[model samples]
Structure formats: structure tokens, C-alpha cells
Target: MSLCLKSITAVFLTFAGTFSAVSVAQAQGANVVTTNFNTVDEAINALGTSTYQTINTGYTETSKATFTFAVPSETLTLRYRTDNTGVALRDDTGALIARFNAGDRTASEAELMAFLRDRYAKDTEALKLKVANTPSDPVAGNPASLMSQMVSASFSNGTDVGPSPLTGGDRARGTASYNHLGISLQTGRYSGPGFSANVTSLPLSYAFALDDPRWAVKINAPLNFTTINGQDYVSGSVGVGLRMPVTENWSLTPELRVGAVRDGNSGITAVLANASLMSNYRLDLKNGYGLVFGNGLTYSKSLNSSGTSYGLSNTINKNGIELSGPFQHQLYGLPTNWQFSVVHTVVGGTPTYIDEWTDVSLSLGTIGSKNGVTWDSVRIGLTYTRANRGVEGLNINFGYEF
Candidate 1:
């Protein structure tokens, strides 16, 4: 069946509307105060004899361009001393919003962003509607951007770029506000268990933008080693997908995947063809926190003409929904980025089962001084998946960005 552009457009609009509920948080009339302390030692040294704390400006540069982290406001500086109470955030009316005691794990830099967002994110429908309006459309026939949205999409492209909910990873597609974001390259690896016992997946992925930054693509191969009952086996799959922003705040990604699952004991390979469609709505929350809500559908068809297929099922449909909430803050003074996410998926037609994957990561990037000053973004993270019908999986990932 051919893809329907109109239906896709409608879906995009609908998704965009769903986020209208997020309120546009307003910063009160406070003057922002920034003190440069590049490292923890520096910050610690300055506070040698006193307890001084101020709500630092929410965050700094994100992959997104010119996006406001939070409105500048006078920081509430407090002095910290041994046996001193923790800090508290308050609204204009002096209503207590949240409090963080010293040494509280929930008071980490990442959670600070969440606190700011919870306090300042939009509230009223009227304001949210106003913020949701798309900017005046760019001139017609203009050249596509080489780096604006593309940077966010390509560098942060999810590991599971294919349609199947089984392998889909992060959902950090770039914003739709502009033609392109920035241009960058990224490579990564992942190793984890699969549906059955003794099946390990080691996949390598590379992601980059096409000629136009508005279009980003990812190519990945899932290399697998399976030990069924006793015998050893090997298999892999190749997947390619592209991200296209339909608007300044929404995008579309369609992927094609092909792979074979080799069973060691049975000595049979299950060939599969999978097609997937994904959409994302980029949301900017208070502070430096960003949220992306995505949904996707994958159709898998078995190529076994002989009817009896391999251990892997032949035909099934998978539906998935994802929520990715990432935040940025200064670790000491350097930029620190982290994300938390949950993905729940359901299968239809046959081989009924459910899958849910949750993950978190912390990232740090440095800008080269001379060599074009490209940013090298590196991240390390852990994943935990709890399935209703199969063994759970755990994985670690390391990614580098150019």
C-alpha cells in the first residue's frame, strides 16, 4: 500500500495539538545572576567559610538553537553551612513549590532542571495556545538548512531507528521549528539479550544528515550470537531510516529493516522484512529540560513460503509509545546532559507479548579549539527492560558525536 501524505499530515497536527496542554512558564521580575565557577573545586573554594547558594540560570547551549531554557531572573542566593537546612523554591505569592535538603539524591543537577520545569512550565490554555503557534513560514523555494534541526536529529538519533518496537531505542528527533538544526555525525554500539534465552545482540550504528540538514538518516546492523539449548549460531540485520520534519515542532521517520535470526539447535534462519513509521513532537519545558513524545507502528512479515517458520514469529504488528525527558545543567560549571525515558509496546495478530524498556544516560561534550571546533558529545547509559512474556534484558551503551 502506498503512503498517504494527507493522513500523515493530519496525524502530525494531532500530535502537535496534544502537547498544547503544556503551559508556558513565566519567570518573575528577578535579575539573573551568573557567577563563573568552572569546576566544583572552584565553587567549593569560594564557599570555604559560608553557605551561599543561588538558583543558577537554568541551562546553556543545547543541540537546539536559540531555544530559551528559562527566562532570566534574579537568583535566590543562600548561604550553606554545616547543619544548615536545604534550599527551597517558591512562587511569586511565596507559596512553597519544592524543597531540597543538602545531600539529597533527588537534588542532583538533573533533578534541579525538573524542578525548574515543574515550577515554570506553562499553566493556562490560552498561553499554551499562543506558544504553540508556528512561526511565519519560511520563504518558498528557499535553500534547506545545512545544520539547524539536523544536528539534534542526527547526533541524538535513537538507537532503534527501525519500525519494530522490539529494537527501537531513544526518541530524540529534532525540532520542527526550522528547516535544519545542526549537522553532526555519531556512532555507537549496544549489546543485550533478545526474546529467547542465550541470544545476544551486538549492534553498531552510524548516523548523519543527508545533503539537506532537514533530512537525517541512520544505518545500523544488529549482529547476534545465539546458543539454542547448546549449539552456537550467528545472525544480523541491516536497517536504514530517515527523519523528516513536517513542521517546526513535529517530524516523520520511516524506516526499512531486513534481518535473519539463526537458531543454533534448529539450524534454521528466520528471515524477516519489517517496515516502520514513527512521529515525534519536540517539547521545550522550563529550565533546560526537553521532552519528546513519540508513537510508532511496525509491520513484520516472515519470508518463509513453506508455511512452517523458524522460532521467531512470521507475521505480527507492534505498537509502541515513548516519552523521553532529558535535562541539561552545569556539573560544577561544565555542561552536563542526562535523560530518562520509558517505552511500552504491545504486539498484535500473533505471538502475543508485551515489552517495556526504560533507560537513563548522562552526557558530556567538549568543543575542539582549532579543528573547526566541532563538539564531541559522549554519553554512557544503562537500560532495563521488563517483558511480560520473555526474559528481561540489560544493556550498556556508549556514543560519540562529531
Candidate 2:
């Protein structure tokens, strides 16, 4: 009788162990919890008492614990049942363990389940360490330490004029404009030993126009007439740049660019080279008032086209200065962001005219004129940016970033 009882006890224990194993497997397979609340805080609160909870305590919980919570190898889905919207986690530094998304309402149940499983498998202790060392607000941290990069593409078309004689006579001239489009791709590394690079390309398009002006000529006067023809212009460039943090609120960047232009009708071609150095300073003012100052110097040189003696036989040089500033909260009842920028270019060396005749010597009476000339120009613009925090591609950009 005693032997029989022992056998029965053993059998009962084996059955109970098998049942427990199956229950654990089922729990692991489906760990997702559904809630009616749209917010993460509300969902967490709605969890029943049966759900497992881990609370952190001082001496026992180290920085590694925080890090584990912050760094997610895969996306973390936060679902708002109230609207069925969701957004993926985008914390790269493992700093934001708890983030609130007001517009994440598009994740499916299957995707959310996969995200949760991947996150659960990460090293929680390591994540905790990272999060503990990170600041509460990533943006409030050192700007120099933040990594940012951008690229843009644009197309513009405009007309150009040709040369003529000083005397009132028809000259050979052509009007041409090309639709120029370019794209740039860039990546940047921030204050902590960062780096960046970009590439740009522009495709060529062609167009032409003609102009005619009639002038009265006296009889017995020397009749000199010329025809003007328009030539299409095509140009493109690619460049790379780097930035280094000089101080807590200042940074310095240096870049180089190379480009070329071709005029098909006139057989005029040239290559362009440019080098620039820039510095930016950030200032924090009262009442959320902030200021940014930027200054830069650029040198550009144009190499003449081969086999062309009249248009540009030699290289030409141009040097310039640029200044810009941004003011925050400068006006009442308006957007807080405002910016102004100006660029001045000083041209040196003999200027090249599209028509070879413009550079040739013309003797009228006792005065003789040569073709080469020099000039300078200044361009200025202003902008206002509206703040749309936590949104991408929703703000307006009027000027170039590079």
C-alpha cells in the first residue's frame, strides 16, 4: 500500500509540472496588454494587478538600469486605444525612457507585438546605465554634442544678355536660359568626434531667345553692324565639409566645392573652384530669447575653357563675406523666430563677356575702349520660422542651408 501511494504522488507531481510549463510558454508568447486610454501613462495605470511591475530603488539600481530602459535595439510601439494611433521609438542615445507622442495613432496590433518582444529581450541593466547618465532633455543638452545633417535640391531658370558696339548698330546677340536642377546628400557627426560629407549633382537643360532694337543711322556714316546670338549655359557642383566645436556655444566649419559650366552655342566652357570657412555662435537671452550669429569667408576662382581665346583666356577670382543672425521672440503677436542674412562679393581681374567682340578693342574717334571690367554685388534676405516641435517637414525653409 505504501509503494502504491508513492507512485501516485510522483505521477501527480509530474502532471502539475507539465501544466506549469505550458502556462509559462503561453504567457511569453502573448505579453501585450490592451487598454482603452490613448496615452502611455493612462495605459500603464490601467494595467490590472496581475501584471508584473518592477520599481527602482536607490543603491540597488545603478546607471546601467536606466540605460537599458533608454536604448531600444528595435522600435517600441506606444498604442493609444482611444484613437488607435501609434509612433515608433526613436531614441538613439538611450536617454528618453518615457516619451509622450501626441500623434502616434497608426500602428497595427501585429507590429506592436513584435516591437514589444524585441525590446523585452534587450539588456535592461545596460540600458539603465545609459539612461541614468543622460540628461532629462536631449535638446537642452550641449548643442555641440548633438549630431545633425541635411541635404536639399533646387531648380532655377533665368535669361542672359549679349554684347554690342558702342555706336548705335545691331549686334549679334542671343538669349538663352537653362533649367538647372541639383540634389545634395549630407551626413554630420556632432561635438563628440563627429564627421559629415555630402554630394550634389545638377542636370543640364537648354533654351534660347532673341532681341532686336532698331536705331536711325545717318547717311555717309561708317555702317558697322553685328548680330547677337544666345547660348545655353549648364553648370553643376559637388562638395564636402566638416565642423568642430570650439567652445560650449561656438562651432567652426570649413568646406570645399568644385564645379563646371559649359555654353554650347558660344563654345565657352569653364571650371569653378571654391573654399569657405565659417563660424557660428549661439547666445541665450532672457524670456526664451535666443540669438545665433554666423560669419563666413569664401574664395572662388574660375578657370577658362580650353580652345577659347576671346571669352575667358585666363582664370578669374572672386572673394566674398557673409553675415547672418537669428532673433527669437523679437516681435509680439508673431512667430518667435526671425533671421536675416547678407552676402557681398568683390570681383577681381578682367571680366569676361559672352560675346568675344565685347572684349575686343573698338576705336571710335580718338577714344579706344577695351572689353574687360570689374564689379561688386550685395544680396540680402529675411525669414521667419514657425516652431512646430516634434514634427518633421512641417516648417518653412526659404534659403539654402549649406
Candidate 1 achieves a global lDDT of 0.36
Per-residue lDDT of model 1, residues 132-234, tens digit only: 2211101000001011111112222332321112212223433221221122222222222322334344445555556765667766565555443244556
Clashes of each: 26, 36
State, as a TM-score between 0 and 1, how close model 2 is to the true structure: 0.27
- Candidate 2 lDDT tens digits, 101-127: 444322232354344333432233222
Highest lDDT against the true fold, candidate: 1
Error of 1 at 160 (Å): 7.3
lDDT of each: 0.36, 0.24
Q: Could you tell me every candidate's TM-score relative to the true structure? A: 0.45, 0.27
RMSD, each candidate, Å? 27.5, 27.1
